[model samples]
Target: MQDGLLYKLAALDSEFEQIHRLNYETFVEEIPQHGENPERRLVDKFHGENTYIVCLDGEELAGMLAVRDKRPFSLDQKLPGLDSYLPRSRSLCELRLLCVKKERRYRKVLLGLFTKLAAYCEEKKYDLAIISANVAQGKLYRNLGFIPFGPEVGSDGARYQPMYLTPESYYGMKERTKLLSRMDGEASVSQKHMNLLPGPVDVSADTERAMAGTPVSHRTEEFNEDLARVKQILSSITGAKHTAVLMGSGTLANDAVAAQLSLTEGNGLILSNGEFGERLIDHARRWGLSFCTIEKQWGGRFSREETEKALDKNPGASWLWAVHSETSTGVLNDAGMLGEICADRGIDLCLDCISSLGTVPLDLARVYMATGVSGKGLRSYPGLSFVFYNHEIASRPDKLPRYLDLGLYAESAGTPFTLSSNLLSALKASISNFSAEERYAELRKRSDWLREKLSDAGYDIVAEKGQESPAVITIPLPERLVSRVLGMKLERSGYYINWRSVYLLERNCVQIALMGECREDSLSPLIGLLRDEMKSRHRA
Candidate 1:
């Protein structure tokens, strides 16, 4: 047991009896007694197969609940009617024997245990949950959206109410309550404090109007003209002569790059420190590309020596890939240094700048190729991806398929092969309002403010001060709080944060990026909430 709580599966030995004793104490001694010999009931066959999640507060057994196959429990003759509403299929689960020690009843301990049970049911894909709610607790189940299947009846003269809860109903109630509570909490905070959380950064009115314009035929000359305009603007922003606008996501852009590079003769080097980098390697391997990697753990950054050594060892490598801003770790690698090394070695450098682009300083002059999306730092809708490559790679005519060929895009179609004129107009409008330099400066300012606020609140950042990405700020969560709990708590408090898990071999941490309309003002209330949550955890 740690932190005054014991969380574990119930054992069949003395611990199980202890839980039974607590159940008797709560139901028989404390509450109204419905069954005879409640103090010492014999262990039944049902108890043998059921799994129980037992929680103890210090030496005191605080709670115990039994979960068993729903089919048997729902269909059993001993229980009140449920077959009328529920199907006999094995798609359901039953939650039984929910008992919390008297002291822990209203303290959220039972709620926490029930929340875990709900999560477990959802994960296991159980379609429904059935419970024989007692008369006194019938309103509790009703409030939770559990409907009674049949008339209330007594089990051996012990008044019980038969209830049924579908997975959809349960989750719907859960999510609705969460959203309502979140909105209420946000409203409780001052508007000045509320605005601290990131965006609904309203898109420019002109840009929205442009996007609302009539759609153009993809094959029409007018469409090509709009496409050309978008291509020029995209290239100007990234300092690349070659840029492509695809109908798919940024993943497609990475796929295209991987497909194009894998056609080469030699091995490739993948620099992986976060989820996206590892995703790139997965894409390469899926496409059967020969590759080696220099990996850093999650929330960890690679040193210059480590990168140089990987390049030195893989002398045959003709292509190198790394993420400019690893959204997972919120760390920005030294792209310029890596680019120079790859260029000098006659290797093509590909960068995943999906979360970086307009938020950071990028020079297409240094890197050979890069992939970005319209959504994340570009602040547009997510349908399009821009692929930028240097003149050398853009001029290559070798083995790339027509669709994946950057050379073909450069020489002929420019950005769009089959374009959405409205998206093109939106891209132009988003870029026209702000220069690349202005975007970079604004991002830097916002990220700095965020870092300061988080640091003031006593959070440890994943990246070093000066080495962090201007677009993202990653913070290490306290060991006592799981990422899921942290995310749910923040969501309830009207803030959404991303958590990292891909490089689990390294560390578990949370990341907060300033890409959206997030501001420093939102941080104050969030810090207060964090402090409260920390106190609650410590108390638990």
Candidate 2:
């Protein structure tokens, strides 16, 4: 309903009306599972316990399925020793009454409902799910990662087979969309907006497959080994001495860096040329770290002279902080030069390398501390952030907040608190598969080509030549054109440009990111689309 499709919990009177009709059509009319009734409605016996997930296509119920965790499942009654027949599990659920309109053509109704089912199971911590699937739809069910178990039940055309779904089994089927596309002819990948944002970039199938695997205890040796391996790879790539993985975002990682900076004996010099740089000043302020800031216009390049003058003015500065890539303006500061300056001045250097880490070649060996995330150019899912440090850090249980305490995380081998093995596994797969040489070249070449295309199309690029980062390209809207208006238009057309962030809105800007697996040819159409938007604006 919202943008032609909506997946939600079935609650409304109207939604229930459609659900009952669809259930009757599926169970009675189609499957011959129920006796015909005058009302033509066949609500399930477990309707009271059922949590129905429905897909709505402009107020029309496209498809639906109900989940109920209460025991004495429909399958339990049909197949007498259900528990004995199945694998051991802590908690199980029953999924029933699945249906999509048989008379109408639906785009992704059933796919959307099944995705919701998977998410709901995760939220409820259901280890396994049981379904008495229609025998005729066995291939479709198996394609959805359901395993058939026990003997068939019911008479003739109404036969049903007991099936179960587990995370491992689901992942096995969902291992790659390539398999699905090959088997089903068309890719069953549900509706996806073209991802051109800076973070939460389109992840690879390997990363998805890794994330789909069942999680292990964070405290287990198996989990710690994965943790150590990821840390080692990160350190090796960035030339950082150590890396501490935390279950948070880039902002949280920066806060951790600020906590470390707070320990410095003298003042720190923070430079602000864009949004992320300004955030560093805020982080330092909140941490009560004594610091001086050198402010410049957004997208302005910080020269060696400007930084040297700032350090000279604050001779006693113990550390320096700045963003390696000012994501808001798409300006990439020279991390190498900054690292050298700090080395010569005997000051610790820290960088917010959140957006720059994977897009650019980094040598953080000289950097005292820096921050990165699991998403961004890594092409992994978000939620995991890293604090890379060049020195051994000890636990500081007394001074900093427990979660932001980098020392605590470092001393404990990056898992002082619970960590998500799902995110960790995905990150490992992405990093392991990443080709630094190839990816860097691709981003740089693509960034240059896109900037040229946009510029030739009569649009102003925010970052001037020699200042732009390969990761994101920020474009300011013209005086008459509203950012939100243009962004909405692009989104409805399936291109998700970054424009809704508070800072971007304040600046009246939108962005195109080259953070993930983007191609030059893939961007030509987008450039033409932008050119069309501008042409229409001019015509109007």
Candidate 3:
């Protein structure tokens, strides 16, 4: 929902009643398409089979349209042999009863209805949509990608031009609508707050320009070179011999790691102290990997003794997995110590460095298979994830899924399937100038300044001084104040901070992630805004 209006299928009894009344208002009184009803409500003849998509403004129906799949549709009555007259489609549907309230016409009621209808059709696997649109609104239909199919048809004084919308037209219109909506949204966001969310960090101007450049085919030599460069840079950063880039989020990379672990014979131990570590449990379960978890309190650091205890419990454990930087709690675990423990036990160690990859100094050379993403510490657009492994993945099991199979990805030279050239190029540009030591130092400086200032302001820090990551800072909200409420207030005041996750919201915690493109000068004002907001909330 947006602009104080909701668009969805009219499923409830009250909603269906509103649809009937709206039908009467539009067809009976306004358009004269139906006979006058004493009840002031007109139900369509195919109401039993029709699925109405309605837009509501604060419980009041503002606009609606009906979709039906039954034979002898309204268009069939006007234009005989409708299928013969239009493009051949296996799964066809008819749309009718399009109407909007007079006062709400200025709003995007029609567009909302169209969007809902499009989603509904897509869900139902509809290939084509036919509409007998009012002749006066022909231009509107055309603009919506509905092509006039046959001769204008209908009874006198209420003639309609039959039109059909194919999948191609529907998708094209949807993209255009999305582009325009995004343009408007970006303008509004530029004048308001800049987002500082962890995953979708603000992209730099050069990366944006790289993303905007003309796309190349994934199989072409140019795209292959770009993909190779991204993998090489990631390999260099992590100090790994090989890296495989996947077209998904960091979760996908972790899932691939889980899948790879499933191929191994013995049990594994997963360390958990935060949300990301917990998610790895789910991934392991989905992959059907036999593993035991060494659980710790959120924001709590893991010691070598704990790792040794978990290994001692699972005597046959073959690998150890843990998150380098627990983004949820701002806990930066000792991966080096954990690696040493695994090495002593003769067990391979896998790390989830999605949040720590470029934020801190990391050495993945000794790591078996570690996950990293293009966004966050990498300072690039999301949609690309990588798994860096020291071993030859081609020697792993061959029965794994095509997308999740590290061997398949490595064998295909990192372009296992259709990779987005734009995303690869943007990531390449981001990492081309990346300096691990310099970025880590800069982030450490910023984190130190922010932590000192925040602690001085009497905030409860989630992570202790020496144990915190260089790029993430978490603070607990005062008693009786919801983190989400304060987060929204900050957002409205031209600032955006991460909060509202179940883990954070339940504990009244808010996070300030220093991942994306940002500077020291920008931090002072942001810190000021946060300080003022907390003070105001304290007063309240």
Candidate 4:
């Protein structure tokens, strides 16, 4: 089983029996808090009124706690004057039945449970939490910010201490715990996904922490400084003169490029070889730009002859657009050739470098415009797209949508209205952690290793040999195998391989993206898993 554990609200009927059984195991058999029943389950008196918080170890009950605010709480019955025992509060609730399985006791089960419970109570507007803690774990309660109240109260040789934890106390104790953990050289255990997708990659601890920092207003000078740094980093990485950060997806960035093109007097040529390239055509059409298309089969490379022929055919075309790395087909188009052609012909070159921005080596000095996102190869979260241009695109069509206008974003220092500080901080952390050139080298090495391994395993690779992008590998499954089924199986095992999209399904392929937060050591294990999965499917 995966080591990751989940803390969530316990579902009634579905989880009641397990909750009762666990309660019996802890309160009756283990702690002797209740009399043993032949039913093998111990139902709490306030079960109906309780909101159960459960810690799950892959659908197995690992630990549980129940919270209730019904009048005359169990603690109230035990202590007549509960208000005097606890501090004054506007809203009060009692915590009960905190239990952890023996196997999971040493893990962070209690910590996770308490974290969820604290959030739940706070959301319900509970100012204070009262609990009758078993005297055996008194130290744990005290460590969790629960203050001992009144005297001990119990019956039948069972003893308990009444304790209360206010929101302030809980938060204060959380800070103390973090500080102590850090002092003790203990790091927070991450339960993040092993992200192998093209976007929203696996975030490093530093990036996560940066995002968790206090959020600031986007209009502040502090945020603008960070935003300026981010744009500078992008420019440095891509060799673009000016980069604009917009709070949207890559499609929006591409649309912004199209919007800029709309301001130009000359028509452009759009090259389509895959989904994203076709989407650029859509963007151009939507922008109502007079553009001609040079369409090619998916996964096919654009030859200089045909490209030049198309450009010659449309002498009025001032711009040539293509996806540098077609994400859907895993084909890395010949940008060098295309850029040279555009330069020789005095035509502007635009690229959809969303997937290649950091995963592949790029020098955008020759290109006039490009689109990228904070996610994908940049190793940051979604919701931020960047438009890298060599020259100023300001004052281009005042009729364009404000949000999609690159000039407006540049004028406002990348925050036209409101942007997310968390996203910006995370992007800064991601880019700062590794240089773009270093990331590109790593991706190339990993992709080569994976391709060699997959080839040895007899998988049919999509992009052929030299035409493939180092960032993504598309593998077509055999006739007997189902691409999406295997993809789902791998997903259940916490390994995400892109599959089942229209392009992939039509091609009977699944894609493995080698971008963003992927480690070299993880490549072999992933290959081994893929081999095993394929073998199993073949055997069946």
Mark the regions of model 4 whose C-alpha exceeds 4 Å error after superposition.
1-193, 536-540
RMSD of each: 10.8, 13.3, 13.0, 10.0
Which of the two candidates, 2 or 4, achieves a greater lDDT against the reference?
2
* Candidate 2 clashes between residue pairs 3 or more apart in a chain or in different chains: none
- In terms of lDDT, model 3 sits at 0.83
Give per-residue CA lDDT, model 2, range 259-369, as digits (tens): 887776989999899989999999988888898999989889889998999899999999999999999999998887888899998999999999998989989888889
Question: Candidate 1: misplaced stretches above 4 Å?
Answer: 1-202, 392-402, 414-416, 499-508
Give the deviation of candidate 2 from the true structure as CA RMSD.
13.3
Candidate 3 lDDT tens digits, 1-540: 657776666644566788899889888888877799689999889999987888887668999989899888887777777778887788989998999988889536777677667667877899999998899999999988999978998777788989899989977876878743553343344233456677788888899999999999999999988888877888888899999889999999998998888888899999899999999999999888898998889879988777788788899999989999999989899999998898888999999999999999989999998998988899889999989998887735556877888888878854868889999999998989998888888889988988888877677788898999978888887875678887875664445789967888878899989897666755665666566666656787
Output the lDDT of residue 14, model 2: 66
TM-score of 1: 0.61
Worst 10 residues of 3 by lDDT: 183-192
Alpha-carbon lDDT, every model: 0.69, 0.84, 0.83, 0.82
Question: How many angstroms is residue 446 displaced in model 2 relative to the true structure, after the best TM-score fit?
Answer: 1.0
- Preferred candidate (lDDT higher): 1 or 4: 4
Q: Which window of ten consecutive residues has the lowest lDDT sum in model 4?
A: 183-192
